[model samples]
Target: MREEYEIYEQSLPWILEAGEIIKKRIQEHTEIKRKSSHSDVVTEVDREIESFLVSKISEHFPEHNIVGEENVGNRVSSSPYLWIIDPIDGTSNFINRKKDFAISVAFCERDRGIFGIIYDVMAGKLYRAHTGSGAFLNDVELNAAGTDGSLENELMAINAPWGSMEEMKRWEHFFKLGTQVRGVRNYGATTMELSDLATGVLGGYVQYYVNSWDYAAGRVILEELGYKFSDLNGDAIDRVYCGGILAASESLHQQIVQSLKESSKEIK
Candidate 1:
């Protein structure tokens, strides 16, 4: 218990420090480079912030392994502790709008989350959680309670994908959900979307694909609020991050999962 508290307490400052670095760095001109595709990108600031965090973690906890978006970390370690970080969750958003990006960090032991922190840099909102303890938006404790569990009354966020047969099929599932919900929104930033979800502003999230750094921290925080996670096909996520993701209340989650599976069969 003490160890969990220590992780959160220590990580809080590190994340805040990283946020400050982001604020200063964004003011200066930042160079962007595309990876895999034009839509997927990285920034010099992304590498800088990640390098900054990696240095801190290495200095403080030399035994922990790190997996970061920028790949600037001491990944080889004998200890079971691991750190996952997305120095900037929305590189494109950060590049274009400069306001929607976030810094996400998570610490885990044996693939189980010890704590997670997501800092909405522009909003100055810090969302964090630890296992067994409820999530929090800064000092305000957050819980998943009193939800109607009705898809019609809830707003959802989706990562829209268009291309290929499988991608289009996933898009169809997203469209189906969009029609049922009160509204659909996209932040282009997973951490921000998740912060809102934890606070009940958004009911669920569906992304056809995401990487470990993209959703790891938010996953830990959301799991604390009774949110259930799974692949689009209804299989348990089990900390898997290289595939589709769905997050919602248990009933709503299963509802979407079943609906998507049924839709897939009929559409093909």
Candidate 2:
């Protein structure tokens, strides 16, 4: 366990080092590619950054497992220490030079996330947390705030592509809650959206789909700072690839879940 923690400590410098590499490449002419969907994007920089991170990690900790967003088959090991990497969280924004992308890394043991780091390369912001240690933005610690559950006064972050029948049903419920809240925002980057929630920049974030690499680090950080994280139905979130993540302060999370339950009944 001590050795794992040391490895995690060693991993931080590599994460920041990779972030510098990404920052340098952000301005260069890079090839953009589509993956899974037009909505899902990737870039040559993403692959390069992932490769750089993997090489550094392997050099430092040869036996550890790695699950990188670009390439995963070669480095996966059955070892307890696993590193999850999203070379660029908002590849579209990165490819287009929008400056809202991030590098996300999480260290887990036997499927339990132990430490997480999300580095906003352009903004020079690093959001990180360990399992028992508290969450932090850069060097300062963070604490979750707000108690008024009035939907009209809350702020929300949601994705833009949920207009289908199934999605609309969910949105109607969220919209009802939105009417009660202050407003809704779309950040276009899931890691940043989750970090916004962790840092209290936004009250909550609701997305219909997200993979493990998307929220793995943010989940641990937010939960450490008195925030709540669960699926839309309010079930405890499994640490794998769970879609429909609903994250917010404890009070707001309950309200959002209750509102969704009521809306579910109405739709039925």
Candidate 3:
């Protein structure tokens, strides 16, 4: 395995360099494309950024396995080093110029995350964390807030799709909890939401669908800050393709999970 600090040190420059490139091209007219559905999207800038990052990693560390959102190659490797990249976490926001997008990158060894970097280009914020090192935003160490899982006092970040569900039961369940929280927000960007969680701006984030690239970097940073993540059932987050995700501080995580479980049962 690569030395902990060395991996972080090597990734920091690359992530910052990539963020610069992305920021420069943010104003350009980039081509947009749909991925799995109309709501699922991608842009030419996404491809360009991923290509640029993959090339840099390949040139510098040819042995590492790269898993990118825009480009998923056929070359599967069992190597210890794996680099996960999400060129743009919020493509819709990027295309619409909404300014909530982010560039996410994570390095893992033997499937264990070691370093995570999430750069909010529009906001000029960078959230980075390594295994033992504390999380930081723009070089300032982040102090995570404590929570005791009381739904009444929590501020939750949930996706917009949940509000438009056809069945009123699930929607009502979510609404009931939504009204009890201190507040509710939808940034349309998972990375930013997770970054906000790390900095204590959000009590937790709930989303229905996200890939490894979307959550890996944020997950590492949150974990370093004494936060936790799991499926709705409170199981370990062992895979990258989980659609339903629940992330929060240790205290709030269980409360959210229990609420979700009860809601799921009710909706069923």
Candidate 4:
């Protein structure tokens, strides 16, 4: 318990400090590089912030394994204590000068995530959680008691690919959910969307493909707030690869999962 709390205590400060670094670079000109296509990109600032975080973590916890989006070195470690990081989650949004970008950091032991932190750099809101400890938005605790129910009356966030015709081949089931909900949102940033879901600002989130660093931290925080998580096929989140993700209340999660299953059969 003491060790867990120590990890939790130091994470917030490091994340907040990273946020400050991100915010300071918002106006300065930075080179952007296309990773695969024009839509998928990275920035010099992303690499810089990631390097800064890796340095800090190595200095403070050399024994811990580090996996970051920008720099993963040559080999991947399967250490029991691992740190997964997305230095700048919404690089496209950041380069486009949107405020929805965020920093996500998660500490996990094997498959169990111990603590997670997501900081909205522009909004100055910090979302954090530790195993068995409730999630918090800054100093305020987020729990089922504090959440607004009325599942049908709530809004949800779906990945952007679900919004189009050509891209909706596999995610058409997800698009159908958007029609039934009160409303739907697409922030193009996983951590930012998940932060809103944990706070009840958004009711749920569904993403067809997301990496460990993309949703790792937000997963811990959301599940702690009584949100359920699974793949579209209703499997546990795969911590290593790009896994389809769904998060919401139990009823909402079931509703979406069942619909996806039924949809697949209908198509066949």
Candidate 5:
């Protein structure tokens, strides 16, 4: 516990400093470029903030390995300590909405996460959590997830195959979950979506595929509050990456999982 706090305190400043850089850079003209596809994008600010944070980890925790979305620095295949980072979790949001983006970081010792931090830069809302400690948004502690363990009338966030989600008849699993909930919302940003789950504002969240940096921090924060995270098939997930994710309360997660498993390829 003491060690977790120590690491958390040390991490706060480094991440906040990176947030400041993003706030400043967001106001200026940004250079945007495409990645795997036209919809997959990265910005100059993303690279800059990631490089800045990588340097901090290198200086403060020299032996730690870093795996950032931007691929900023010296990366390794494995290390005792690893820092997963998404300097700008919502790069497209930063470019479009400007206020919906966040900076996400998670520190892990081997396979266990020590702490996680997600800073909603424009809103000045910093969500953080350490193992055994409670989750927080800014200074206020957040409530546990699945308070009622019921999904009735609760908002759901779905992130899956873009095309599958767009075309109603595509992926029956995603489409079915949408009907089971009161309503559905997608921020196109995993950190924000996960924070909503951590805060209990969102009843549940699911994604067909995501990188390690996308949900590593959120997984730490949510798990502390009794929330559950697993691959769509309800299997344990590793920190590296996975096919998909289903996050919610234990019971609710299983219910959703069952729904996904039973749904046919195309809705009849």
Candidate 6:
């Protein structure tokens, strides 16, 4: 476990270096390619950054398994020590020259994550956390204030795509929650949304679809801050293929889940 913590410490600099590279090239002209849909796209910079990160990890930890967004076509072994990388999350935002994108990384052992890092390249802020340790923004530790947990008084980050049928068929309950909350925001980047949640600025976050790399980093950081995490059905998110996720204070989490359940029963 101590060795794992040491490795976690070593990854911080590598991630920061990647963030610098991202900021330097963010404004340069780049080519974009469509992925599953037109809205889901990838830029050349994304591929380059992913390759660089993978290379760095390979050089230092050759035996560890990696699941990177750009190289998902290749199979990753179910090794106990694994790294999940989203070289440039919110690629569309990055392509549009928006400052809402981020670089997200997570290190895991079997089912337990050791640490997570989300670097907001444009904001020059690094959000990170290790198991049992508190979450942090840059060097300052983050503490959940234990206030503003109510939906009517708290802000939430609910990505716009979640309301679309392609991402979720019966997501109307989520839309209803939006109206109940004090304010709702669509940040286009899960890492930023979850990072804000860790800082207690955003009370909650909900998304209908996300991969392991998408939420893995946020999961570790938010958990360290005592944030509640679970699926829409209020199940534990211990598996890699979590169907969906809801993160908030424990009370707010239950409220959202209970609301969804009632809404579903009405539909039935």
Query: How much lDDT does each candidate structure score?
Result: 0.85, 0.80, 0.80, 0.81, 0.85, 0.82
Candidate 3 lDDT over 1-268, as tens digits, reads 3476776887777778887887788788787778778878988888888887888777777878888888743134767778889989988888886489999998887668788999998888989988777889998999865756587777789763543456455555566557668899888889989988888778998876678889999998988888888875678876365577889887788877777767667767
Clash pairs, model 4 backbone: none
Write model 6 residue lDDT over 76-165, tens digit each, in one string.
665578888999988888877568889999998888889999999889899999988778999999986373356788888865353466
Clashes of 3: 1
**Model 2 segments more than 4 A misplaced:** 72-74, 145-149, 160-170
TM-score against truth, every candidate = 0.95, 0.91, 0.91, 0.92, 0.93, 0.93
Clashes of 5: 0
Sort order, TM-score high to low = 1, 5, 6, 4, 3, 2
Ten-residue stretch with the least lDDT total in model 3: 160-169
Candidate 4 per-residue C-alpha lDDT over 1-268 given as tens digits, one digit per residue, 9 for 90 to 100 = 7887897897778778888888788899999999978888999988888888888888888778888898743124555788889999999989886588989888888888788998889999888899898888889988662333554687888774634666667666776777777898888899988988887788888887888899999988987777788887777765555778888888778777877787667765
lDDT per residue, candidate 2, 211-235, as tens digits? 8888888887887787778888888
Q: Which is the winner by lDDT between candidate 3 and candidate 4?
A: 4
Q: Mark the 10 consecutive residues where model 2 has the least summed lDDT.
A: 72-81
Give candidate 1's error at residue 128 in angstroms: 0.5
Clashing pairs in 2: 151-180, 151-181, 152-180, 152-181
CA deviation > 4 Å runs, candidate 5 = 164-170, 265-268
- Minimum summed lDDT over a 10-residue window in model 4 is located at 143-152
Which 10-residue window of candidate 5 scores lowest in summed lDDT? 162-171
- Per-residue CA lDDT of model 1 for 6-62, tens digit only, reads 867887898899999899888799888889998889989999999999988888888
